[model samples]
Target chain A: QQPVQSPQAVILREGEDAVINCSSSKALYSVHWYRQKHGEAPVFLMILLKGGEQKGHEKISASFNEKKQQSSLYLTASQLSYSGTYFCGTGFKAAGNKLTFGGGTRVLVKP
Target chain B: EAGVAQSPRYKIIEKRQSVAFWCNPISGHATLYWYQQILGQGPKLLIQFQNNGVVDDSQLPKDRFSAERLKGVDSTLKIQPAKLEDSAVYLCASSLVFQGLNEKLFFGSGTQLSVL
Candidate 1:
């Protein structure tokens, strides 16, 4: 099943902080985060596997909560370059563990 | 290493017509995927291939959608009798491993399909 993401869109200023959440009804083996600029392909940011595993890329970090079947992405000191649509792909981890992406959260970072 | 490559950045077709999208995955990558992303939505996996063999296609509409990855290097997704709802961006992605769920995915620019 597709995971559910909160706060469909968010606006932030330079040096500001924001959080995006992704939740799944079933247990997830991993959660991958990606950012896509307008008219561009999505770029891989980080992936959180299992509970307590934290992944970071510069000022962006993500944590996986296995018990809650949720993942959270944190953006610190947002920059204009951070403006993009963020997507969370949840993996159920069967034999192959195919990733199923959730509806994205749009982030607009301004000066 | 080069990322996934897709052709015909954009396509426009009338309803009931047919369209195809091509993808060239990163060399040596055994896992390839095709996704459909509607405006304002996330990329939805349409099919997956493990070295030219079918793995999963639960989300693909078998009646009108078909995909193949011959020689395990490139893939093609075709839609026949396309409907208005079929308009979306077709994205191609590849990974280094077939069972590594957390591995990074490399995506292509995607083909924008517009059905009138």
Candidate 2:
């Protein structure tokens, strides 16, 4: 099943912060975060496993909570380059490599 | 290293027509996947292949959709008798492993199909 994403769209000025959430009904093994710019392929940002360890790339970070079956991506001091659609792909035991993605959360960072 | 390669960035076809999309994954990548992304939505896995063998195709529409990866390198996805709903972006991605904390997907720009 596809995960649910909160705040379908968000607008922010440069230097602001934002949080995007991804919630799944099934227990997850891992959560992968990706960002896709207009007319481009989705690019990997970071991944968080069930153990609760958080990973960060530049000013972006993510956390996975196995107990809650949810993950959250955080953007600090957003830059214009951060404007894109952010998607979270979840992996479960039964799904194997078939990662089901959530409806993306569109983030628009203004100058 | 090249990320991934896809052919015919854009296509327009009528319903009941047949279309095929090609993909070339990164060299030495062991896993390859095809995802369909509709407008205003996330990418959905259509099929996956590991070294020329299918790993998962549970969501694939077997009646009219088919894919193959020969020699564990390049792959192709074909759709016959296309429907209006089939108009979407076909994305190709590859990874080193199926499971792991560090597993990352490298994607191609994808082919946009418009079925009339």
Candidate 3:
């Protein structure tokens, strides 16, 4: 089952901030965040495992809530280079390395 | 380290035609996966392999779509009698392991297919 993403698309000016949410009906053990620019492969941004372990990469950050089965990605001080599609892939409880992805959220950071 | 490699950066074919895409995963990687990403959507897993043995194909359209990883190295996905709906970017990814919670996927620049 695919997760659901909120704020399907967002447009931001440079130096703006945005939050993308990924929620799944089933509980997830971990959540992986990736960004895919046009015509390119999806690149891993970060992975948030259960128990509220946080990982940050430059201006990108993410958090996972084990109890709620949700993950959120934070993009602070967005730049034009941030324009791309953000996807959240969830590792379900019963599955092993079988991640089901959510409908992506498109972000456009303009000057 | 080199990431997954996919052949045919782009393809254009008419409906009812057949096409195949190849993938070479990162060296020493044990798991490889093929995904179909429709426009404006996240990729959907078509098949997954662990060291030349199929681990998953529940989502794959077995009738016209098939994949194989021979010698636990390179892989190929073939679609016979392609349909318009099959026009999507096919992505290949690999991971070091097929189990556990800390695994990460490395992807290749996908093949963009336009079935006319």
Scoring model 3 with DockQ, what do you get?
0.75
Q: Which digits, one per residue and each the tens of the lDDT, describe model 3 over residues B1-116? A: 78899999999999999999999999999999999999988999999999999988999999999999999999999999899999999999998877455688999998999999
DockQ scores of the candidates = 0.84, 0.69, 0.75
Kindly indicate the candidate among 1 and 3 with the higher DockQ. Answer: 1
**TM (chain A), candidate 3:** 0.95
DockQ leader: 1
Give every collision pair in model 2: none
lDDT of each: 0.92, 0.92, 0.91
What C-alpha lDDT, on a 0 to 100 scale, does residue B87 get in candidate 2?
A: 98
Off by over 4 Å in 1: none
At residue B90, what lDDT does model 1 achieve? Answer: 97
Candidate 3's residue-wise lDDT over A8-88, tens digit each?
999999999999999988888888899999889999888878875788989988888777778989999998999999999
Cα TM-score of candidate 1 = 0.97
Q: Kindly list the per-residue Cα lDDT of model 1 for residues B41-104, writing each as its tens digit.
A: 9999999999999899988999999999999889999999899999999999999978477689
